[model samples]
Target chain A: GAGVSQSPSNKVTEKGKDVELRCDPISGHTALYWYRQSLGQGLEFLIYFQGNSAPDKSGLPSDRFSAERTGGSVSTLTIQRTQQEDSAVYLCASSPTSGTEAFFGQGTRLTVV
Target chain B: AQRVTQPEKLLSVFKGAPVELKCNYSYSGSPELFWYVQYSRQRLQLLLRHISRESIKGFTADLNKGETSFHLKKPFAQEEDSAMYYCALGGGRGSRLTFGEGTQLTVNP
Candidate 1:
């Protein structure tokens, strides 16, 4: 893809239900990132991936929020047991390498009811 | 820990007015600072980086190590510049960015 792509531009789920958001990063990019954007909160770092391995997961809000990338390309963010506070835009970005400019996806708006 | 702070959540300015968006960060090592902007209904894009020292669309930001601030400034604001601006800090190689809360800039004609 010419840019980072996120699936299901919008997702609404009931409390306690699990949801999975997917991301397809730009081809050949070695670095991928996940962020959560809430109203007034800005972008919160969630995870960072380098070649399919996550070197940083400290930003994950809780254990229920987990993510993984495979083939050094597509990635998935799974939220177990959604909460109302979890409602936010989940953004995905990819860079040619670490510490470089990142290209972002349109973002998946997750609304937990 | 690395963190970025943007004090203003909203800013308004008349066209051709000077504008400044303040940003401050706390990082142990020399950090990479960047300004990202998002126009209405558009994706977030890079406006400039402190490392480049180049101006983009008339906007520039300088990283002040003594003050730990990277403030974005422009001599003349334009309507097209109205958007949400974010300040981000990176810990260097293999590190993720820490973003500020962002400021919504509105330029009234």
Candidate 2:
């Protein structure tokens, strides 16, 4: 892809339901990241993936939030038992490598009702 | 831990006026800094990076190690410059970016 791409631009779900957000990073990019943005808030770091090494999951807010990147190209973020607090925009970004400027996706607006 | 802080939540400026959006960071080591912008109905995009030392859309940011700041500035503001701006920091072994609370810049004609 020319830039970072995300799927299902908008999602509405009931509390306790599970939701999945997908990201397709630019070709040959080795670093991918996921972030959350709440209304009137900053971007919250979630997780990061670089190559096949262990992902840095320190930013995940809770056990219900998890993410996985397959073959270092496509990634998926899964939220289990979503809560009202989960209603926000989920953004994904990719950089050619670490310590470089990253390109972002349009983001998926997840609404937990 | 690395952190980014944008002090102002909202900034209003008139067209042709000088504008400055303050940003500060706290990091133990040398870090990469960047400014990202989000316009109405548009995706977030990178406006400038410290390492690049380049200006985009008439915006420039200088990373000051002594002050631990990366403030975005422009000599003259324009109506199109109205948007949400974020300051981000990246360092350590991970590729994740730590962002500051964004500032919404509104330029009036």
Tell me each candidate's TM-score. Answer: 0.92, 0.93
Instruction: State the weakest 10-residue window (summed lDDT) of model 1 chain A.
Output: A50-59
- In candidate 2, position A62 carries an lDDT of 100
Per-residue lDDT of model 1, residues B1-72, tens digit only:
888999999999999999999999999898999999988878788899989999999999999999999999
Question: What tier of docking accuracy does candidate 1 attain?
Answer: medium
Error of 2 at A41 (Å): 1.7
Q: Give per-residue CA lDDT, model 2, range B1-109, as digits (tens).
A: 7778899999999999999999999999889999999998899998988989999999999999999999999999999999999999888455467789899999999
Evaluate residue A59 in candidate 2 and report its C-alpha lDDT on the 0 to 100 scale: 87
iRMS (Å) per candidate: 1.5, 2.1
DockQ of each: 0.64, 0.60
User: For model 2, how does the per-residue alpha-carbon lDDT over A1-113 read when each residue is reduced to its tens digit?
Assistant: 67889999999999999999999999998999999989877788899888888999988999999999998899999999999999999999998887567899999999999
**Model 1, C-alpha of A101: deviation from truth (Å):** 1.6
Error (Å) of candidate 1 at residue A68 is: 0.6
